[model samples]
Target chain A: MGMPLELNTMIVTKGREKRVEENLFVLVKEGYRLYPIDIPIDVKKTMDSDSSGSAVIKKVEWENSSTTITYQLVSLNSTN
Target chain B: MGMPLELNTMIVTKGREKRVEENLFVLVKEGYRLYPIDIPIDVKKTMDSDSSGSAVIKKVEWENSSTTITYQLVSLNSTN
Candidate 1:
């Protein structure tokens, strides 16, 4: 099987405290949506983090499904 | 269309400070693997969080793709 094609990804390096509506729009702008109550959001987040780990917020669209969107957002992991 | 079949979801409500190796095993035990570096881990973490928010680890397997697992683990969001 081919790797899950990443249609898009957005990193929120600034403004972790922004409104949830704004954070949600970030995904809408990128042509993606939230992954729903299931799926592992934590693992997906780790994938987006850089070595410094300032990065947060991710939106992904799988290749096979046009309707399924993977929207992820983390509030700049406090450990950083 | 039917909802993305949730094959399995595991929640870890304790031991957030354990080693990464241990975390990886947590998923393996649940028959799940961490999603690649393109999915949203942050959002997944939030999904795992209960109203009290002590939960951290998550492991999920998609029904469509057995090999494609969604394993997530957050270090107990500090705010919680």
Candidate 2:
């Protein structure tokens, strides 16, 4: 493969890390390689009740070094 | 590009659909083309306070048709 697809993750410290890993692993078994994006951990706000967005790190390998995933929001309702 | 990467999603009526889409979109513009895997929306439990782990749909495009991202959970503490 060239550059792997980038996936952002967050460990809210709510203790769902395992479940989240399980979620991520599901994707891995499909074919894509895993490589964690190496960047300064950012204290960003994310979904969930936790005040700290707690970004999930240790992403995965794939792609031709695109750096990260990309895309812009287009709708409130995703029908496609 | 062959088959686009497959991502599983769930839309619990918890009201984070917009946020999740925003999350997914972040990945798209990165070089991925999304396509929803047409399956009967499975009523499964997910990670959250929400009882139903509503699956997000309309994944993207990229790659040589592998059908989904792949990898396996290898550690409790993801260092890489």
Best by TM-score: 1
- Which consecutive 10 residues in model 2 chain B have the weakest lDDT in total? B69-78
State the DockQ, from 0 to 1, for candidate 2.
0.02
Model 1 C-alpha lDDT per residue in residues A1-80, reported as the tens digit of each score: 42233332333323223344543423222222234322323322333554223323332332223223333343334553
lDDT of 2 by residue, B5-66 (tens): 32444222223222333323112222342334443233222335433322334543455432
How many residue pairs clash per model? 8, 42
Q: Give the TM-score of candidate 1.
A: 0.20
TM-score of each: 0.20, 0.19
Q: Interface root mean square deviation of every model, in Å?
A: 11.3, 13.9
**Candidate 1, residues B1-80: lDDT per residue as tens digits?**
32242332333324333334643423222222234332323322333564222223232332223323233344435552
lDDT of each: 0.32, 0.31
